[model samples]
Target: MLPPFTEETARLKVQLAEDAWNSKDPARVALAYAEDSEWRNRDVFLDGRDEIVGFLTGKWERELGYRLLKELWAYTGDRIAVRFEYEYHDTEGQWFRAYGNENWEFDERGLMRRRYAGINELPITADERRVAV
Candidate 1:
């Protein structure tokens, strides 16, 4: 699962990420990243796996019923770009659909070394929710 990925491998990588995030397991998801991974998630910047785990923990706590879908937009060398959508509801029961894109750089070991993401959210009624989870 090193870099220079083929189409099949790239798709696999995307699917794996989607699954990990959907699991809502911070530690599990963090395992895919390097020890000193760097990330720009929305407006916040994070460094290292510890920060990733903490961020995800808080995120999942705030975003109930989180469900994510990610597609591989492109891949070259050790870089991958993804387009993603996710749905979640806040504690107040207001639902939201988030659309985003992420650029990821991987180390030789296939661990993500850097990630940059931009995201926007739209309010939605419960009836508008598409993902079952």
Candidate 2:
């Protein structure tokens, strides 16, 4: 079983998630989830690994030069909450700083079964960009 998390394990899980997302590989990130994982990212909803892959593919494609940082906010048993920030530029080179929180539920094997993310974006100049890879 993967959850029933302790402070040490929860912190490690958060860092592992951060590393996976930073890899920018859709498949790699998707592997962290269960086969039928469900997600609500902003206004979009997705189910299953294939959908997760597609979603992340499109996200990284448009976000452009994405970099992220995630911090463990809280955890108990099978659920965890995280706070994060990411910096990205659009195709037109307009930079943005995205701030977000995610709530995650993991199955017995430690793969996330559910994810709910809420985010807000603020336009910033490249000079104001803060997140470093």
In order of appearance, the predictions have TM-scores of: 0.98, 0.97
Q: Please give the RMSD to the true structure for each candidate, in Å.
A: 0.6, 0.9
**TM-score winner among the candidates?**
1
What are the per-model numbers of colliding residue pairs?
0, 0
Candidate 1 is scored at a TM of 0.98
Worst 10 residues of 1 by lDDT: 1-10
For residues 1-99, could you state the per-residue lDDT of candidate 2 as single tens digits? Answer: 377999899999999999999999999999999999999999999999999999999999999989999999999999999999999999999999999
lDDT of candidates 1 onward, in order:
0.96, 0.95
